[model samples]
Target: MNANVSIQSYGLVAEFDTPGDAMRAASSIRDAGFRKWDVHTPFPVHGLDAAMGIKNSPVGWFTFFGGCTGYTTGMLMIWFMNGFDYKIVVGGKPLFSPFYAFPVCYELTILFAAFATLIGMCFLNRLPRLYHPLLKNRRFAAVTHDKFFVVIETADPKYSPVETRKLLETAGSRHIELIEE
Candidate 1:
């Protein structure tokens, strides 16, 4: 690596003393039409999602589809074997009935639903990320403990260094710093 390599700015991070401050800052950032920004806090904050203008998650849809697939697959498999492929008659009972397949269908529905939820969450979050510039910032480490933070990425079209800094300042940030990549 070259010693004189120039570091690129990742974004601006503002630290707030309380979740309310961070939520307010997030609302302001959201209202400003910034597309790339986030707020971090030690724990979940009530109404913060609304403040950030976040909509409902689509993960539930994935789970629903997966469950439907699983149930359909179970029913079809049972029907193919019992009703179509090789018929078995015992005690004058029907070849296939939904009551008999209910156990397998129910189990598969739960299994596939759980798998889909995990996969959807990972896909939506873009997980398995090995690194992020924010992880290197010492000040940001407080986010996991006591502090709340709002980060506005430089990639956002609405981001202006001076204006963003001023916005954070006005939003009641106790400290603000530029992150580098």
Candidate 2:
């Protein structure tokens, strides 16, 4: 993964052997006005979301949009197909009555909402990324094995590599390194 090396852009990365330290660092970093940051750990840590200031995701908005699209499409399909193309009046009911198409519309809404939730997450997070600059950091392998890491991206406006290192150092971080892009 190291072969395709980019320019050495620097950022602060703090490594901890415990989740507690990682969470503390996350909170402190967030309080310090560092928005471009991420936390990684071997296992899910309780209260980590609060520490990182992560709020409810916007995925619900995606699902809502999908539901709306599905409802409109389903209604249009039923209107055009059943009412205009091939009208059928069963039990002396109105041919284009919306009540008859309610079930199909509801089903399509749920189906599209579910699909949107799944696809929205993947899209927002930019998943299926086979490579990341951080993957080149040898010490990062322990992130999936009982270690915790917090990285502040260099793109952050307040990101001065030296200042970030000092901040992390004061926040009880043990080992810190500069991640190169």
Candidate 3:
């Protein structure tokens, strides 16, 4: 921290001692119609995704489409280059046999699907996020150790700092801090 620098808030974050309390707080916030919020815990908690109203991730869809495209492209490539274009004739074997292209198609399908899954994940998670205001909070450091925290960002149109604080307090947050950017 530099003395000349001024702190700006990114959001209000609440720390809870127990995962149960944190999970409850997440549900409360979701029910309150706040979208720009998240819950962090030291380890995975059961039913938290349902409590937070998280839907299935789109990475699977991306991977499916990518695999379809890869299969089509690979099949067409093999068919055209081998059967239609070059007309490579071997001993008693059809150039356009599906059996011959199976391995190539399978490899390409898996390759494309894997690439799409990785890219989709990165895009959806907003990766390459090198910095965040919450990272500056000392208390937030314990999120990876043994703390359950919920943060509601200022970006939410419905966010009310005073009201949010009251809600968090009601939800059983032991300590709260406004993380500065």
Candidate 4:
């Protein structure tokens, strides 16, 4: 280790004894106009999204468009293969009846929708992250077992160490610590 190396602050993490405490702190932080804060808990907390002011996700729209594209592609491919190209007149049926293409279209729609959902979720959440600063914090390990925590990133423009610490303390955090990057 270099003795002259300077440590950088990743953020401030406030530990709460209960979900309620963490939720309250999160609400206070959100109401304070801090944009880059997050909460971690052992299990899901009801109404946490509302407290955090998180908006509805747009992944559904991706699924919708993917399904539409898949259906259109399936229909067009079938029509081109069976009706226009090969000209297969099976049992005197019509060239391009939707009833015959429905099965393939439905399967393609399902496949594409599922793929879109996975890709959209990964893209939106920025997946494949192999590491995070919080993972290096010993206390944060309790998040997988029992404790709840709220972290406010230093990069947030509204962050002030003194004021943010005071806010967390007022919100009933049991302990607060600066996280090193």
Can you write out model 3's per-residue Cα lDDT over 48-98, one digit (the tens) per residue? 999998888878998998898788878999999999999878887998978
Estimate, for each residue in 1-181, the C-alpha lDDT of model 4 and write its tens digit. 9989998899999998899888888888889999989999999999999999999999999899889988998999999999899897889899889999999999999889889989988998899688899999999999999899899999999999899899999999878999999
Root-mean-square deviation (CA) per prediction: 1.6, 2.8, 2.3, 1.5
Candidate 4 Cα lDDT to native: 0.92
Over all chains combined, what TM-score does candidate 4 have?
0.93
How do all the candidates rank in terms of TM-score, highest first? Answer: 4, 1, 3, 2
lDDT of 1 at 116: 91
TM-score of every prediction relative to native: 0.92, 0.89, 0.90, 0.93
Of the pair 2 and 3, which is ahead by lDDT? 3
Candidate 2 stretches with Cα past 4 Å from truth are 1-6
What is candidate 1's local distance difference test score?
0.92
* Model 4, runs deviating above 4 Å: 1-5
Report lDDT per candidate: 0.92, 0.88, 0.90, 0.92
Model 3, residue pairs in steric clash? 8-181
